[model samples]
Target: MLTITNVTWLDLLCLTGVGVYLVKQVLIKKNPAPYPPGPRGWPLIGNVLDMPRIKPWLTFAEWGQKYGDITHIEVLGRHIIVLNSTKTALKMMDSKSTFYSGRPVIPMVGELVGWKDSLPFLPYGDRFRQQRKNLHRVIGSRAAADVYNEIEEVETRRFLKRVLAKPDQLQEHIRHTAGAIILCISHGYEVKENNDPFIDLADRAVFNLSQATVLGAFMVDILPFMVKVPVWFHGAGFKRTARKWRETLEEMVSAPHKLVKDQMVAGTAPVSFTSTLLEGSHVSAEEDHAVKWSAFSLYAGGADATVSATYSFFLAMTLFPDVQKKAQAEIDAVVGPDRLPTFADRDSLPYTEALVKEVLRWNVVVPTGFAHCVTEDDIHDGYYIPKGTLIMPNIWFMLNDSRTYANPEQFNPERFLAKNGKEPETEPRTMCFGFGRRICPGVSNSHQLTNSLHLANAAIWISIAMSLAAFDISKVVENGVEITPEVEPLPGTISHPKPFKCSISPRSATVLELIEQDANHLVHDNTL
Candidate 1:
């Protein structure tokens, strides 16, 4: 046991460092006010052991019930403030955003993999404001975003044909369609129907991002010093992983941007977010980098969120046939069987809109949300929050809280409608996109304002409407018995509905003809 082989230097280094960290923390002055209530963390390691390895939002929700709305915890000498209620989150992150809009630079995901330039991990500063302003030019308002309706309609129609051909590959079709639309919008690039290089590259990068951001997934995140450790050292495998992931991420960010630039030089670049920003400007190296990264962020953010929501919509349709039937009935009355529903028809279909809202509310995507870093030392609600504290809003609990939503577990679109003289429940879009200055750009908003056009929400609505109009989705039958899919969301930065079985078929021959007609139209139309 005393031999060096039995106990490596890494273990010794970690233990010694923990002891030093604890001693240093103990020598510091006490808090100005007590931290908001939370689980009592152990010495040295703090709450590291108490933190859940999976679905931490569930644990955070339990903490919310036990210790008021705001819960505090410390891990590796870092303070975290978990806001479990919308009211508390709004007051802290919204009303006082000046002190709470910063994002903690994750060692593994950011510094190691060079993802810091992207919005999800970007710090709140002038750069952040600039990127938002850039997005404003493209998707800032509904009218501005409507400029791309043909693109959305074209790609979505292709999605229907893909689904019709390969019903078993529904998720793949959704992923492909999402990438295709975002690629067109971001760089005017067209993705291949199968095994596209750009799609493969971006998918691998995003998966790595989700894995890298998981709490305690890699030791480098906790002991940031580990990043500086030699790759040759034992137990330094994550460095190798970070290297490979960084390459993938670099390609994901640069490849499409390069394509746009090359096309621009050739005098044949289509109008897109990237092209529009670069066309008339003699851009400096620094400005060019900003444009490239901002375009990638727009693509990454809008695409991933749409995939999650659209996939969840299918899961919802399978799980609740009654809801699906009700939605289809409304669609039938409003849209009819002659053609599929389009964005122009969205306002006339209230029940379908409610159904889409319910899908969003019923399934919590981005469950815990990315952490919001505190920029200054401030006391919130009589509790002292240190300058570098990470403020995490448990968005799942807020959406599912029974106090706000009656029968919160039920999949009922009626909850969003005024029925029997009862008012509608609080809108989920207001809370789901997140809070404050760092609220997700281009995400859904309750009131139409001068912000990005809620691309992900818009994509989800169009896909759901068109799919419902074209197909009937239900549980699969095997061995003469219908199989119901189990409801579970896989844990990650972007939560996705677990794999499920469903049967999708054309609602009528007319719908199939409609899909064919759209495809024929796209074949002739080069603008899309």
Candidate 2:
């Protein structure tokens, strides 16, 4: 039935069909990777619209629930992987640290903060390792512990004074004392009272840093190509703000460095982080100056973290009297009313230790923490994570995960205590600093020593001195309405409560004398 033209058409059709089948098989073999489960979203803007601008931590947690422990999403062509479980975070971010330790290049933090040089935000490479080595040499766990006596002395005295004189501004006092201690150690400066130069500078620096990291700033980071367009033509406010922040931060950080260096040359400098850097620079002056920004990174990082934690401690004490009573009782039973607790007593004070962990869990200061970027391709649970993926270990969710803690909502210290009231069981809370190889290197010694010796006991003493002794830290109610704690914290990578009122008083005559004596002996360091 076929004619000459029909015979040719039949031959062409058979060849075309064979070609199609071969191409399909080749494509399948070339790309046989699987992605983690995630909510389906439009191309080039996956889940961006769904993400909450503020409190993205809560939103991320919800997504983790909808998706599995490891969820993948795309924002403006960039891939992000959120680690919801501790096991996965530790396994990938820790065990395979070389791949997950680098930080994402956020425009606000990187461009504005000179992050090409900032240690915390720097990528995982030789430069980062060098900077981290410097930090370890100067303020590593062991060295941090060594510096605790000064931290304890300064913070403790300030707490005692605040309990005796100004209770309303206790929050500021606590913040100032903790901040000033880090400032002094980092730059050889102490803020004895309000309006100290160092304190003012640090406050402004934090504000600018926070403003640069808020949700608004991320708009530019998410769409960096917009930044390539002329500011006058495209007309976005991101460029202007980014420039201002860079200049402000440089001025704030550079001025202090110059002042400290000058003081050292003029023979008036005390032992400080800057001084240590300078001394070490003599061995490798060129390299050290190149990474001098690392020193400022420590100041900025250590200052705010400690301050945030202490402020939360105050809030916790104000809200939960029973928690305070138990901690104070432990402090009293171990050290008695005559003397203060120290780092040596940490093992003996199990309840106090539990309270510190509970505070960290209750109000997570750095909820999402700083973002970490994947350096290479990796696999977790049969899914492929490509290189350059932004890995966020959902620290807030891990701490509050109901599966781990019995009642995650309430601020209960007893959760960390032993069930039978014996020596206590395994600590329920995980590391608040971070996980794996990148876990906060400062934690083991300097940070821990400072908290254990002065800050922790200082908070307990302040709680006992003010709440138990003078003021009632119970909730305030007015006009037939119970006023919940007003914590309109300045939005940033970190947060603290807004100012509120709480009653203050002295518990007894014996306690009152000890407070007064302690305050008198703690001299204003400026006049020293």
* Highest TM-score against the true fold, candidate: 1
lDDT of 2 by residue, 1-528 (tens): 854334442243344335544654576343236878887765334556665567777777998899979988865446788888777877887778878887777776677445446666767777777767666654554434345454556466556567568776766776677666666666676666766766766766766766666543455576554456455543455677667667767776777778888897898987666776675436466565644676666666666666677677767776787987777677667777665555457678777777777877877766776678888787777888888898887878888888777778898877777777554422433445666545553443222443333223333333333333323355555776765676555567766556666544555566667666644455433211
Regions more than 4 Å wrong, model 2: 1-31, 214-216, 230-234, 280-285, 421-429, 445-472, 476-483, 486-490, 518-528
TM-score of 1: 0.95
lDDT string, candidate 1, 1-528, tens digits:
575336564575458558758777778887799889999987666787787869988999999999989999988778999888999988998889999999997899999988999876788877887788788777777777777776788889999999998999999999898888778888888889899999899888877887888866887877777778789877788999999999999999998899989988899898788988887859988778888888888877778788888999999999888989988999999888798888889889989888888888888877888899999999888999999999999999999999899999999999989989999898888788788877776553334433545777778889999999998999999999999999988878778899898999999889889877646465312231
User: Candidate 1 at residue 366, lDDT?
Assistant: 76
Whole-model Cα lDDT of every candidate shown, in order: 0.84, 0.63
